[model samples]
Target: MQAKHQLATPAKVLESYRSPLNGARLQQEKVENLALSEQIDQFIYAYLQFNSKYQNATADGKIPHPTKAKLLSQQRNKLDTELETLCSRSSSIFDQKERGKTLVMAVDEYLLTFLQLSFVGQRSPNTLEKMIGRKKRLLEFLTYKFNIIDLSLDKLQYQFIDQYYTFLLVQKNVMENTARNRCNV
Candidate 1:
């Protein structure tokens, strides 16, 4: 039937579907995808320019020898193949969430989520303030040690704890008990 065919169309199916996740997360994902797409476009433009120049040079006999020109052509072909493969694979990158692989949350984002949940659970304001203060100190240490404010959880190691403890004791010159509490936080 005409109505059945309309319902089966890709655009209609997408329009009728609703996602359970929050809008902010979806927006963030779209932003990341756009950035990646922009990067790919830039690479493709650069490749086209390079290919044009290579073709012009080959036609004008600017390349010194036939053997060298052949080598250069082979390398160019290999690069073109790589670009095509990348373009083909890029579509699946956004589908990683459906493939059961969890995306890594940055340290700051993880902390913010934790704080938000704690607040929603009616945690004491004093406790929340202490957590915020500790987070600030931890961020400071992270920046000092790695030159980064936010890091992926997978990048952390057991040594990070020891290093952080030492930083609190030595850099902040806090009491041992205070340093321990901060580390616990």
Candidate 2:
């Protein structure tokens, strides 16, 4: 009786965890993917440090430093290969939803890309997060109001953007500067 009761309790807990509309797991997966990308960046940085050291030694008349050069080259190759693998893995995680002949990405995918780019550019964490959050809100508005399925720059016309700004004004009651800042993201 005790074992059966314990099993039932777990089943009940799981029942609450699997909401059809809950995207927590999907978001968590995206965060994990972004963390992996950050790891790749660190590896690349290490490779760069090795390369810098090798370059400095070569500049100082130390020609053919075989061991250090070989180590740097190997590290760089490994980082490059790892980056490729991570990119492939990330792409595989995205679902292809056809929206008017364009592939629309999920919010998590787009946000993850934004985060990766920011990190690659060496942006501060606060700045990156702020920019990403702004872009996210804009994407949400486009998705909800205008049925905008894709976030292609070519797809964003002045008229649509104007309407979005108006939405921020009328619906969200945000300031003009805030709206402009969000669009800038």
Candidate 3:
């Protein structure tokens, strides 16, 4: 009765049904079939294959010791989590493209699109220059915060806005009003 109850628990039941591959086979197949243009996607596919082979080797007692196997498994799990994060970020970008949405991959691209669509001839040259200056400040902040000029819009969150505002005020030594203006842009 106790064994039945233990097996019936949600966690145990879920674990029992989960594939040992943890859907890596399906993800690998998808990666193989998709004509991935990004170099990152290709790297991810290679990593997936390497990870699968590593797991198989470990299971075949290549590691030989229980402790070392456990340690390697822990490290592998951490890498797997990071890989999943990368996959989700890249997949979301691809999905956005497939949906026929205007894909703005970087801050500068988004700024250009916004200006072209909304204020090309309507705004004065001075006003456009000021807008561009604001965008430069934003790009500076993004570079300081993320180390990358090209960031996916999908990865941005409310906390990013808050952090950028703080970065402008503290790191750039800008006034609160100026920080607010930069953030609003």
Candidate 4:
């Protein structure tokens, strides 16, 4: 009886060890989605700001104007569709069994495109790496502070970035120049 009980205990332990339980947050996918959403929001903000200024200038007839309004409208529509797609991709974050490779790839492509469009030219490798690192830190901080399991665009704010920088200074003991470099990087 004692020998049987000992063998059964090991078997039970093995069974529990192999139990299929996966409730932990998918942090990588969530962070990636959040970053992609941030990129989209930043691009839209840039586009709208420029479009508004361009429209105002055209209305004032400051120069020999072309049909820039049509171009802006087309870009807005495209951004709307992309935003919808981002929402759809974010929805997948809740589906525990679903793999997000396609969603990730799409976001990656859009992010690269957004970077190219925003820069309009080549960037130094250091600058590009710094931007990526800052984004990574921001996502990590948000995840820690907010228990943000899903990377939704609505969670991000300009104020969050400021708070995150402050967090690095006070909590991480980062110096002013180091914090500024990390934030801007």
- Residues 1-185, candidate 4, lDDT per residue (tens digit)? 24544655767777757764442444555566557566555654554465455557567566524666666666667766665666466445434446444423344444555554543435433344445555556556756777653444444567766887888898778899988877653
- lDDT of candidate 1 at residue 101, scale 0 to 100: 23
Preferred candidate (TM-score higher): 1 or 4: 1
> Which candidate do you rate higher for lDDT, 3 or 4?
4
lDDT of 4 at 17: 76
Candidate number with the higher lDDT (2 or 4): 2
Please give the distance, in angstroms, between residue 133's alpha carbon in candidate 3 and its true position after superposition.
1.4
For all predictions, the C-alpha RMSD in Å is 20.1, 10.6, 20.8, 11.8
Q: List the residue pairs that clash in candidate 1.
A: none
Clashes of each: 0, 0, 0, 2
Expressed as tens digits, the lDDT of each residue in 82-184 for candidate 3 is: 5466556556654554332221234333433333333224534344446556656666777798886444556778998899899989988999998898788
TM-score of 4: 0.34
Q: RMSD in angstroms, candidate 4?
A: 11.8
lDDT (Cα, 0-100) at 160 in candidate 1: 85
- As for model 3, its CA RMSD to the true structure in angstroms is 20.8
For model 4, the run of ten residues with the poorest summed lDDT = 99-108
Candidates' TM-scores? 0.40, 0.39, 0.40, 0.34
Q: Residue 67 lDDT in model 4?
A: 69
lDDT of 4 at 183: 63
Q: Give lDDT for model 4.
A: 0.56
lDDT of candidates 1 onward, in order: 0.58, 0.57, 0.55, 0.56
lDDT of candidate 2 vs native? Answer: 0.57
